[model samples]
Target: MPASRCGAIRRADASENIWCMTEPSAWRRARAFSRGPESTGHRLTRRRRARMRRLAWVLLAGAALPLHAQNPVEVDAQHYRLEYEDKQVRVLRFRLAPGEKSPQHEHAARITVVVSGSRLRIEDTDGAIYEMTIYSGHAERQPATRHTVENVGSTVYEELTTEFKDAASQPPKLVVKAPPPPPPPPKKEEPKKAEAKKKEEKPKEEKPSVAASAPTTPGAQPAGTKPAATGTTTPTPAQAPAAKVQPEVAAAAPPPEPQPIIKPLKVRPPEEPNRRRRKSFAAEEMSEATVNNTRLAFMEQGKGQTVVFVHGAMGDYRTWQLQIPEFAKRFRVVAYSRRYHYPNPSTGKEEDYTYEANVRDLAEFLKALNAGPVHLVGHGYGAAVATLLAERHPEMVRSLVVSEPGFDKLLDEKRAYRSHWARDEIYNIIRKPLSRQNPENGVRVYHNWLAETQPWQQIDPQEQYERMQNANALRAQTVDPTAPAFNCEAAKKIKTPTLVVAGQNRSPNSAEITGTLAACLANSERVTISEAGPAAYLDNAKEYNDAVLSFLGKH
Candidate 1:
């Protein structure tokens, strides 16, 4: 409720009895004029005043009514369900059963994470109708608006929508204006003629006494009085010049009465039940922090040579869940979601999601951790990031281990994936789906694209969750404007010992890519593990860990 409205209500309630007490009762009506009958004009005048009082109350009540009366979830519980809410954001799980429709409801500015995609028609607040397809694991930022949804598709439309509630980032609401203060006291007239006459006579009468009170000696007056030469005391009316005496009179006058200090009664906003729970949930999950002013979600454990885990495409910090535990037993491990992945909010603009942005985030992430010269372990797209980090900032890396690295910069397009079936299959799996904003399908393609890799079930549940969380990141990974270039010659110059691991069950195409990369690095060694496919770390954990541990031991 607005402050103005609340006060209006309070004022109305306080004055409700005042009208009855101050106004005459109808029972106190006077006798009819001429003791015959009351004039119709007089009766009408009384009735009009009574009607006006009732109308004032009606107007006051209408003003106190809320601006927004409909609570979206409460009004349309079937379609809109509160997930988690807080002062900062409100998380809602919105869905419609197949063929189901929803009534109009309002939503604030929000970010929507689609769990299931479908074709749907919606009527916006302005009464415009539009049809759009929502894809699973796809994310979008929406401004505040009202709308109704109909699940035109056979399947349900599921979304995890988070709305900001704090004026949606707008300025704070204006406080209500208070009632006017009472009128100030009236001014008083100056002194009368009698007082004025006395003021003139005082100068003449006091001059002699003032002089008599002073010492006869030229140098000093009485001990109780200040000497003329000292000038510390205010001069008397009789001895001082007329102009000086005027200043004395002004100074001697008493101060005016102070106006009472009126401080507004501070009204503390009531705690929202939903928001209270939301904050509790946030406390349990990953605590949010920032890097380069960009918010990041991460977890850290252990206390040795920092082993920073960088994830690949369609992946996040959770991808390293298995590695972190095992490695943290012997070394410090840091796992973090790259920008726009999982809990890490998106920068939103498509142009912001680029390889350069990823690298810059990675650099700042490491700097924020402040664990100097870390041992780098990265998988898939993460492996590519590790490669870039090592190349550009070699001093920050003590040793490097990259699994199934995705550096196509070293590829001779015609002889490599370009003319080959690998490129075509890869495109069919990821690219085509991304064209339609369907990263869910792309995620399946990525995990199962290489048959030689471990079975999908072999991946840890937490890693799977991370992958699903960042399914939307797949498109951005494919569309990065600043794709990295692999330099075989530069790799040869690196003094940092590097271990490149590949899946023993990987296809010939996978082997060729890794083999070429390892050959480029003079101090690097290539290891092929038979335990898993392209993703040796997850598909073949035991062998992969041994390989990494052994290599880390040497370097």
Candidate 2:
């Protein structure tokens, strides 16, 4: 073959073609090259074959390139730091100096919170470039993307980002709007004239009253009945209507006017047995109390001794949907949303989102109610607040019922460490999702981790919506650094009648904390609700209510 043709084929097939050309005999190569005058046809075929092989190799190499690159933290270590990570989410802190550009990287769906304002230029994989102006404290949710970032402004750009690891856990875009009013009930139709006349003519027969027909004395038989050998009396046929009335008088009376027949209204089928309906209180039924300069929304029912329900993080007065109705039958029931919870305006201050603040609010709330010392029932974080209140102002509390109080500080050194570790684990799992402004996913992660069963899926949609409304409070509590410590010494001081309730299937950390509290309280009794976890009241409402009510009755 000619030098140019041999060189092109060698480059295309590499060593194999070169070895074949060099090893072949000189005569054989000459014969193959001299197929025709200048071997034009042979040369053209070889060139086409070589080009096809080269194209195939190029395509294969292109296929080897990755569609998505490594994580941003791995690709740009100088600008990104892995702050936290778990199966559900990964949190990273990023900072870029002025005019600094980062290599292309990949990120999952994430929520970015701007720590410092700056102008940024983003270049996507498809070569699309966009400039964005961001401000400090601004947060926005982003979908999974591959891009390169550059700080185009004069100042450095900094942000904290939470990337969702599970696509299903991504927060949904929520739109707020008033729900449409329910449809009007179907109207009833009037009975036809013929049907009304038939019903009117079918007169109801008159029968003697039992009191008039029965014998007045015991063991006495009626005039038409005869006693049997077995001491059972057999009655003859009922007496015939008296024939004293004249036929002419009866025929003269006009037939009673046709009366309409009323049919029973149709009712919708009952919902699933496990599904709970949303409980709504009328405007007149709900009342508000300003406590500690915060307007607390509350609902009250029944009349007697006052029993106030304090809800935990991510809950409002509606958390006691089950308890309120059951308790209201007897003692007066009051369930109020704490400060920053749903239906209440949030000051957005970190200091107002602690247990101490909650306890102070509860004390002031009780004073405002002026219902005397009231029975206090609290759950989760609220349970801790209830205990603190009892310790600080025993005079304001009649009795205390705390279910699964999350006072990890009260446990022994070993148990406290384990509790803290578990808490951090859970926080890591939910922090990213919560930061993404997706309360529903946060709620799902937290509850799914706390219990073996899927509590989030089992709850009513209205209840889920209610929890999402208080998600900000939960987020604040999770990151609060000034959480008040509750040692056993404080628990020992609470001498009020107390019931420490826990779930039989509660997490080990929760069980330890609650058990420690129970051990420290001098006048406290502990009860466990079966088939329940951290949210015993929701898991087994009847059992939880009975236990709480039984405890309240004594105090």
Candidate 3:
């Protein structure tokens, strides 16, 4: 789409081409007669004619430009959902129904992560037709190309396209505007009256027709008829054929119940070995243990009293990848992905995830491991899960370490806020996206806010794209209206020794929340890890691990 690659070069090529046509007779005679050595029209050198033909071909190549002005994601919503976007990268989820064909579209150089199997028939601009079979998790690098697509497989075709936006830059003029025009606002409706009526009726509107105890998507109007979560597919207006034969959406099963606490058990805390640094902490293999009806995947190391690590939202057991190996050298360490996380097969079913559901899953897993008086370490949303479990089943937990726990209750008990609070300003960045029906952007906006970074950070595309995959997990949590709040009084009821790990970059309000939590827990202590944000484990593992190890060594 670069202008120099197209328009400017095309104009120059056209002008030179016209001159070439007009001067062909004169040029032919001159080439055959070289001033004094050669006679006119007697002979010509082959090399010059070949060079001219090559020049014409080069000019033709320069004239090629994008056929239309549209981005692939904006071009096809049902088939392509924006998984992530930052200054450096853009990740999109690509899906297609069997026999469906997409209109010709162009993509920059990208890497595709195939999550499901599909056979595709491609019709390239050069008129070549090719068929391909893709397996799950298959990664293929793609060059910039324009093409139409057809799903030849009987099964659905899905893959993740992670475009490295930094590979090249096009001039502003060459950047195509979207095809769809933005809708204008209605002039007839009185904004104030409509808003006033809605405010009065909102409470009644949010009530649900179906009664269910399962955690609802963050979008669920737990309070009243706000509306179901935004990401759930209804019908998109894009002209592309609607995909049929999607994975069946299953009704959420009831949350697992915590089994009766068998025997009270106590396990001694750690003295970790001072091991050398590892080459890489990326998991090469995983071990699995079944608890409840589901199989839980985990990693195990060391051999002492048990320490189970739980991850926050948009994370799996892998979130603690760096810390687990270090801790395993001293204490028996177990880190497992939560339900619906990587390594575990996707249910393909949608449900609102909640602390209660997570707690039930973890409790059963711990019981299955036969490790009680377990040292519990949780981060962010995982921290909330840990706290809830500790409060409900104190006997199963020995000590608790929660990092930057998120409970709406923290937002509610704000002595810092005057008559007006600015948190909503932060909240609305995400709200605006979700309200405008851009759920993926809403997820990224919230993550950017939490990390205390600009709306988009410049990082490796694969790294960001891998994390963007987690954005799908945040959908339910992002809009869950029925999410539980952090209860200070309930936290006070917890007698298990607790450590609250507060990161340095937290907002004053967040700092207060952690501080208040420490104050409430009768036997709790707070420690701050510098140069870290919501996830210290990821930002600076050694500092985070050392703090955690030091605290555990005492208890």
Candidate 3 lDDT tens digits, 1-555 = 123333433343342221233345665455445544543322235346767888999887665532224577767665888889876678888877554678767787788887655568897666667998776568888877767798755345678888766435221223333444446853432443564465556554222322221112222211111112322221111222345212321122123444422211111111112323233443233454445544455667789989999987666666776887789888999888776554343322235455677788888888778876899999877888899999999999989999877565654443333101223333434544544432546655555545532223443333333344444455445444344555688888999999999878664446767987898899988888899866677777889999999888887
Candidate-wise lDDT, in order = 0.59, 0.66, 0.60
TM-score of each: 0.45, 0.50, 0.47
TM-score of 3: 0.47
Residue pairs in steric clash, candidate 2?
A: none
Judged by whole-model lDDT over C-alpha atoms, candidate 2 comes out at: 0.66
Report the C-alpha lDDT of model 1 over 85-149, residue by residue, as the tens digit: 65567788887644467876667667889875656889765557798866667998887676678
Model 2: worst 10 consecutive residues (lDDT sum): 261-270
* Candidate 2 to truth, TM: 0.50
Model 3 CA deviation exceeding 4 Å by range: 1-279, 290-295, 347-349, 411-443, 452-456, 479-481
Model with the higher lDDT, candidate 2 or 3: 2
Candidate 2: residue 285 Cα off by (Å): 2.2
User: Cα deviation of 314 in candidate 3 (Å)?
Assistant: 1.4
